[model samples]
Target: MTSPPRRLPGEGTAHTVEQSAGELARLAMARMDETLGWYRELSAAQRSQVGLVAQAGISQFVEWLRQRERHAPSAISIFANAPQELTRAVSLRHTLDLVRTVVDVVEARATSLAGPGDEQLVLESVLRFSREIAFAAAEVYAGAAEARGAWDARLEALVVDAVLRGEADDSMQSRAAALGWDDVAGVTFVVGRAPLAASSPDAPAATVDSLRRAARHLGVEALAIVQRDRLIAIVGGTRDPLPVVEHVADRFGPGPVVVGPTVPHLFAAGRSARAALSGLTAAVAWPGAPRVVESDELLPERALAGDLPARRRLLDRAHRPLTESAQSSQSPLLETATAYFEHGGSLEASARALFVHPNTVRYRLARITDVTGYDLTRPRDAWAVRVAVTLGRLGGTGATPGPAVGLSDAGQPAPVGRRGLEESSNL
Candidate 1:
């Protein structure tokens, strides 16, 4: 067999450097101090930790050169010898700065330290090592970021759960603050069907991410959770939540999406959550409801479903306002509205029943609409009015069926006519 090939000068120098690894490490550390401002910015403990890392890196480089024929050592593992806490104390950029400084020192000393004709080879190896170190730093930071993101998601889910269960307290607020919810100005809960899991195992998470992305685009804050087949989101930072809801409506699955009224803050978001969840539960009652419907608009359906809060809401928003006006017989707007509805919305019939001209009935209906904010002409508004009237009657308010009133052109009560009495009886 041929005599073993004589070791190259570059190979011999690599062995020499490995024998003096401790000296090379010290030189790298000194250069790090001279070159990097951020290094000096580190605390004493952090700086000592970085020094250990620098030393390990130089020693690892020498070991890799000695074993070059076996296999190149992994540059990433050089950081393994340092305490994991170093990753936190030194940011990726700062870590990269350290790596650059170390590499620069190695490159500058290569000609003097390496055997004849080995300087170029040593410099090339330092370049390769620096590249790998940068990649390793990036991996470390990415992992940390992913871990933080997952923890934040769990905390967000908890906060949403607390709000839904109406158990929001100081601890929940603290958790919310940790998730950066301090700037939220107003809060509203939105509920809709979650995306189907058949499409993807993480479809719920994806849907929530989509909602968050949409909320961000709208310059609002959102915290969402996937509970069974429903996805609920607490949206905040906007007084006018309708536009925000509409902006994010497409993120929810196909169904009626209900938005609760905007509460003043997140702690009061439980009110919005209660209303939104109730609306979502009762949404089936209105099959043709708009894609984005306000929780208050679902009161009639919610009340019909035995929701006491909905019943009270109907009384407050529809029944009480109308009935309060009926306390005075001079304001015949309520009676005219009752006759208008009872007479099948016929202007002529209501006019005849009220003993007034059609124009007078029209004027009274206008006044009623102005007071109640419910236009009698619209079918949905008509349904709300009818439901309110029924609820008022059931509540023993005597606010329904509109007491008969005869009105003259001067807008004061006039004596009832026999014809009007006959027409009223027919109604």
Candidate 2:
């Protein structure tokens, strides 16, 4: 059998603390108003809720000292009587500040609230109770944080999906706003294969969170979600997203990571998302591409992969320019460039086939570079130039072009024996 609990000498002190609980709560509020800038800024309704919490704390302390509670006082009940909104209005730090202020008020009045020989007990109890309250506050906030994190994760996925699917309506905008994504400027989309380690359904969120943190460290705003095998990240708050993508490129799985062109804001992010995803699909064609290749950089591959927009861009920027160059000038750059590719990139060979001086071939090559920005001498540029020329000749539907002057059935310029005069045009 348990021994009867011995009576403590603090009964008189407990009775005094209980009787003065209302006045003590008022004193704590006055002290908070003087010391806590945040407290004074609370709206009237919030302040009223806070007052109830303080009153509960003081009455609970009296019971704790009376041995009515054999265990640590439950702060859960203190918050129970208060409005749920109070938890958010008052952060854990502010709650702790309130606790400290109340503790200070109680300690200052230990002399009056305690019986003659019970002053020491009252002071020690305040110190112990304050420690308990601190622990309780941490526990409460930790629980709140977990619940918030889960909710935010679901909301994040919805916002990301909506953007990817081009459904960013007012409802989606409001949902994105809930996740703090409103007003993000210079938004861009990045797509890459999810890391192998995050292949598990439960593991992807943790990986995305790491990416989000890395982006935020650079002052970029980011939202992330993993769809199927792909990890999509929408980052903003920076005009140049190149560095931001490079910074987090290593966090993706081993494959080409594609960053789309930046848009003005979140609402325009679907354009970026489509391009980046298309680029990621086409990236496998170029094994030597950089770890973080921009969507614009993969236009040729994407065109070859049947992406209409990329095909249109190649037609406008690459293929059409070469054909147009022939109209304004007598030299046939398209025929010369094709022969240059057929003869193993030999500039002199292409010159012999065209019967122009090597210097003329060199000049036309320079003009080609100017017309389309593709340097035929470089391997990558050579490949892109050839692809564009082929697409233009075979696919150029409405253009002012055909096999000019010198010809073979194969559409290449037929070689002429060295002519007395060299090819020259000033246009």
Alpha-carbon lDDT of model 1: 0.75
TM-score of 1: 0.77
lDDT of each: 0.75, 0.79
In model 2, what are the clashing residue pairs, if there are any? none
The sequence of per-residue lDDT tens digits that candidate 2 reaches over residues 1-427 is: 7666534546677788888988899999999999899989999989889888888888888778888333557788877888656778999999999899999999999999899998887887888778897888788888888877777777777776667667779988898888877888899999898899876656777878899999999999888876656677999899899999999987888899999989998889877877787788778889999999998888778766666666667778777877776776567888878888998989789889989888988898898888888888898888887777777776746543233222333322233222201110000
lDDT of 1 by residue, 1-427 (tens): 5555323346679777777678767877777778778787888888888887888778777766655343345655667766766776788888888888888778777887788788777777777767766786798778777776677777887677667656678888899899888657788989898766614556766778888999989999998866656678899898998998898888888899999989988888877877787788778889999999998999888776656666777778777777777787656766777888899999999889989999998787777678778888888888888888888787795433221122223222232244432221220
For candidate 2, what is the total of clashing residue pairs? 0
TM value for model 2 = 0.86
